[model samples]
Target: MNLPLNRRLFMVGAAAIAVSGPAFANTTHIVEMLNRHPDNKKLRNVFSPSVLKVQPGDTITFMPTDKGHNSVSIDGMMPKGASGWKGKNSKEVSVTLDLPGIYGYKCQPHYGLGMVGVIIVEGEGMGGNLDAAKDVKQRGKAKAAFVDHWDQIKAQGLLTPPAEQ
Candidate 1:
């Protein structure tokens, strides 16, 4: 069948838009919980690959390789419009990231020892809440651990400071 040139062009443009539109499928990242890592850090029970970079709409699954651990967001580290979440101790939990920013989380049971993790989400012109993320008040080893991870993020240029962006 011979179709008009205009109709063919319109159909092609529609198809391209559909293919390049916002992604509905979510990517999942796996994080393992380890105990007594032997590396000598805060919070003996730890989350492997402590820092992860992902795009908006991705998901992260925290699996308890050892018993008695759960993932929870820090008090002031999430984006402006993002909400806090926590998983039940010893249970596997998957969190879907909808906002663009730096998310700092920790294991409730071992927060003092510094069982913490970070997730950096990059989106289209996404201005992250860097100041809020930096203000997360942690105690003892947890504070030190967060500092170390934050430094790495800055050094690696994974995400730019909101002020500078």
Candidate 2:
């Protein structure tokens, strides 16, 4: 059957949306950081499943397998700040990403070693062109603003040290 061009386009669009529905669910994705490194510091890596793409309202759980390892959001997508810690020995850190933008994150202590990751919140025409590491650098300045407030955070006890190594 020869369908009209508009109808065909509609069908294709609908199919694409259906196939990518799971990526937009308001759920959480857990990413762990293994505490394995020659220096006993957290390895400079995003741990398992490096690439994580989730929809708005979804949460990403960062769990440190070793002590002294933590994940900090270098992008403004997280409400807290550019840097937040999930102590090496602490439980999982759950972040509900409710905005529609690309978010970059990394482990502060290990950032110099290139340990980084990204989260792209599904929204109008923002998909299909995401570079995890690049996003972190682009948002570097905004992240710095948040990092400046670290002292206040520490006083609040929001910063938890990793477990005893």
Candidate 3:
């Protein structure tokens, strides 16, 4: 059957919209949990790129290059409606982040030495989790180191750059 040109264009546009949706634009980022800092021995046992900033619906894969580390979210550092996650010890875990906020995470066994990481999800604004993460009452050496990491993240405009080669 033959159709008018206008009708054909409308049908094609509608089909295109149906095929391309928000999910098609989501991205996946890879992060490594390393056993040592390449340049600083004192920084041994850390997340390669200790900080990350991503859009909502993005996924992050936390892969442990070291034998004894895990990525676990800080108790209070999630958006109001966001749920937290904890990867299996020393294993690779992929998480699809649907909420927009700041997330602070740490290695369960190495929190003291500051084996920590932070993530920020862009939303309406920086979420309410930042203060909570800062006031977490951290213990051991991490108490001071965590603060330093947070300050650095803020100084760099809230994005942790990829580790230097």
Candidate with top lDDT is 1
Q: Report every candidate's CA lDDT.
A: 0.83, 0.55, 0.81
Q: Per-residue alpha-carbon lDDT of model 1 for 15-105, expressed as tens digits?
A: 8878777664568999888886636664477898798988788989998888999999987888878888889999999998889888999
Q: Candidate 3, 132: how far from true, in Å?
A: 1.8
- CA shift at 79, candidate 2, in angstroms? 11
Ranked by lDDT from best down, the candidates are: 1, 3, 2
Give candidate 1 misplaced runs (Cα > 4 Å): 1-25, 36-43, 124-127, 161-165
- TM-score computed on alpha carbons, candidate 2: 0.50
Estimate candidate 1's alpha-carbon lDDT, on a 0 to 1 scale: 0.83
TM-scores, each model vs. reference: 0.77, 0.50, 0.79
Error of 1 at 159 (Å): 0.4
Displacement of the residue 148 alpha carbon in candidate 1, Å: 0.6
Which candidate, 1 or 3, has the higher TM-score? 3
RMSD of every prediction: 4.2, 14.0, 5.6
**lDDT per residue as tens, model 3, 49-93:** 788888889999998787899999888777787788999898999
Cα deviation of 16, candidate 3, in Å: 8.8
Quick one: ranking by TM-score, best first? Answer: 3, 1, 2
